[model samples]
Target: MKQKVIVQLVDTLDLGGTERMSVNLANTFQEQGWESHLVVSRQSGGLQNYLNPEVQVHFLEKKSFKDLKAFWRLSKLTRKIKPDYIHAHSTSIYWAVLLKMLVGSFKLIWHDHFGLSDQLEENKRSEMVILSKWIDRFIVVNHKLLDYWQKLLPYRKNSIVYLSNFPYLKLNESIQKLPQFTFLNLANYRPQKDQLTLIESCKILDNEGFDFRVLLVGQQVDSNWETQIKQKISEYSLQEKVRVNGPSEDVTSLLAEVHVGVLSSESEGLPVSLLEYGLAKLPVICTDVGNCAEVLKSGELGQLVKVKDPKLLAEAMKHSINNYEEEVGKAQQLNQYVLEEYGALKFFESYQKLVGAVK
Candidate 1:
């Protein structure tokens, strides 16, 4: 019988990048003859149908994010499943280690999707110092965090793997032109994503008589922040220029019809939206934060400006529109590079190596 691997996450149905990547990785394992299953803390997100039909999903319906009872339940489930490996994505690492210690069978592997500095809250850094020792392997999404881990946690240098999230959608040969007035930002409305910057930039464009439209995708993690942004848009009389479209599974198709892709995040691991934009052949303008600068090859593929600089962002957008041919060339080059580097085959190989090393 094939060895079993259990992938654990806080939610299986959230349309966020990490959640989607977890589903993709779990599905890939099953294709390679491993018995793969997903254990979600809750079932409220919209991602259940996205899992492979063959793979099973278990929901704990934890009472809350801080429910200690859920951790006990997870520990029991881990013992019952007796998986050959336990791959924990995102915040589940906190419990994955303890569960493995309790069950004493599964090997623990943790994937870190955020930047090193953002790993824990400022007040909880002391706690992170304590927990870092329990992780068997640390899968990082970029070189910056890989370097940070190597310098501060030298003993773990050998266990740090640099693999990025893979693109989930494939492109069509019949390329379609984007609508004349549409631009897009695909990220949750949170402080980390810096939607205020995008809103300010759109206001600048509006004042300059640019006839452009904006689509803000992803869930609003902060309702107050969303309301603030809406008020700003109204104050600037930009209702015709901007619309918050909530979360979307149709982002790939939407990107195919958008003139430009924008990411104004204050930080990121490796944005899956940027990869999707490349696959859709849409030009991009993003902030020089997290691994975004590295992914764009230090501004070779797309325009990268400082975060929260509305004027600079607006200027970059104008430059992209005015120099259409150059922007298209950059898009083509980035599309080629992203496909070659982050294809699903490569992702599968990385996981295979991780599992094989432990075996």
Candidate 2:
């Protein structure tokens, strides 16, 4: 049989778990001998640098979903590639929905990479509910999302499934070294990330004379959110302890020096950062939301704290420090678990089987 061609569609090549997952799957499939292609609906960003050279990239530079010119452009590309499946991630599903209508050849696989699965009702997209019926299949990054989408598209219950977000291993070491016990957060500045809670935790740690340092590493997506986080950092005089910065290509190397990995997001859907932390063998302190408790295996692998609770987060941070050796042991356990459970090969095999059965 001929090699199957798979195409991944996403809104951007930005630094987020969803975008990283798109790139991850594309790279994995291509490395596994499939003709994998990646399609970016709008502008491309730094994450594009991580893609495998074997994979082809197409940029639509779409102004809006209604941009007919871009739609036609994508339609033409679809005819040329005639892919067996178009796996669209997050917002890119909108375009995929349109493509399915226009071309009517490829299977539409819409992956729900929504972060606010904890608050799905409040943030429901009417357009998605209306258009979801067009999706040939659905993939969710977390179990909560699988539940949400199943309820929304009850007719497609059998078609929806949950898959874990695999890690994007950072191989190179960071150029600069942080303090021995510095905390690292690999998330973009978004409201859902709730960087404020982390700032408050930093303040609590500082006031309690805990002597800690936090390195915020990820893309600066929301200028407003960035301003708010930095304003809080400045107002609290946390300039010394909390270092809010932008994306770094050196995360794998940076993991070498950081004492722990942390996420304070009010909502998340199996963040890839946590998987990277586990793969890097770093102790974790994350807010209990989405599949985090499941990913960390209910504190068996890493520590899980209540969401939006700075005091509790601060306490967890303190505990990690006070029992550094124990946390390290847990980190080692997490490393083995991530390797066994969230390896890229497993994801590729699962997706290959799914695609093979789709027809």
Clashes of each: 1, 1
What tens digits encode model 2's per-residue C-alpha lDDT throughout 55-88?
9999988998789999898999999999989999
Best by lDDT: 2
Q: How close is candidate 1 to the true structure, as a TM-score?
A: 0.90
Q: Per-residue lDDT for 52-107 in model 1, tens only?
A: 89887777877776788887778777777778777888777777777766776767
Candidates in order, TM-scores: namely: 0.90, 0.95
Model 2 segments beyond 4 Å from truth? 170-177
